[model samples]
Target: PDILHQLVKGTFKDHLVEWVGKYLEQVHGKTGTKNILADIDQQIAAAPPFPGLWCFPDGHNFSQWTGDNSKALMKVYLSAIEGHIPDDVEHTFHAFLEFCYIVRQNVIMDQTLAELRDALAQFHQYQEIFRMTGVCFDFSLPHQHSMLHYDLLI
Candidate 1:
C-alpha cells in the first residue's frame, strides 16, 4: 500500500502538472505551467492551520490527500491554474477521477481481468498523462511502474 500510495501521489502530481499545463498552454498560449503549479503548491503549503482546514479558491477544504475527494483536489488544482472556475471542466474532471477510482479499486481486488479492462479503457482519456510521462504502450523502461521508484527518489 505504501508503494502504491507513493506511486499514486508521484504519478498523479506529475500528471496534474502536465495536464494543467497543456490545457493552459492551449488556452492562453504558453503560460508558465511550472511556475503556476509551484506557486499554488507553495500557497497551499503556507496556509495557516486554523480549524484544520486548507481552503482553496473554489472553497474545498483539503484536509487529506487520499480519500473520496481526490477528484475534488484535481478540480481545485485546475481552478488554481486559471484562477477561475471552468464552466464545463467539472464533467471531464469527474470522469478522470472516476477512472482513477476504478484503477485503485481494481488493485484492491487482486488483479481481476474485468477491472484491468476498465482501467485500460479509461486510459484513453489520459493521452496527456501518457505522453507527458513518457509512458510507452508496453509500459517499458523510462515508462512503467518498474522505473518509477528510481526517478521518484531523485
Candidate 2:
C-alpha cells in the first residue's frame, strides 16, 4: 500500500484524528464539563495561518478529506492535540509523526535508519493508550500493520 494514501490519509486520519475525537468525547462526557470536541475544533480552526501550511478553518470535521487535506492536517494535528490528551497518547502521535517525517526524506542514512526504528518502537509502546482508553478494542486493522514493513523497504 502507498504510504501517503494508506498510512497518511487513511489509517492516521481514521485512527488518530477520528478516534481521538471519540476518545476525548468519552473522557469528557462523564462530567459534562465542556464540549471537548468542539473546543478542539475551535482551537484547530484558530490556529494561525502561515505561508505554506494550510489552515484548518473547519478543523477535522469535514465530511471528506483530500490527500492534500490530510497532509496539511497532519502538520497541525500534534500541536492541536498536545495538551488536550494524555501524555502517552501525545507520545504515540509524536512518535508516529516523527516516523512519518523521517521516512519521507529522500536520503536515508544509517542515523535515519536507526531513528526510524526508534520512532516506530516508540509508536508501538505508547499506542496502547487507545485500547486502554477503550478507543480501540484491538489494533487489528490492516492499514495499521503496513508501517511495520518500512524497514523491509530499505
Model 1, stretches more than 4 Å misplaced?
1-7, 30-54, 57-72, 75-96, 103-113, 125-154
lDDT of 2 by residue, 1-154 (tens): 3888667976788778777877877887744424666666687898898987888788778888888888888888887777789999899989999988887889999999899999989988898998988898988877778888886787
Tens digits of per-residue lDDT, candidate 1, 1-154, equal 2434433454444444345556655554555644555666655544555653544543323465563344335534543444521433333344445444554552344344345445434444444343443332333322224322322232
Least accurate 10 contiguous residues by lDDT in model 1? 145-154
Question: lDDT of all predictions, in order shown?
Answer: 0.43, 0.81
State the TM-score for model 1. Answer: 0.40
Question: Model 1, 56: alpha-carbon shift in Å?
Answer: 2.3
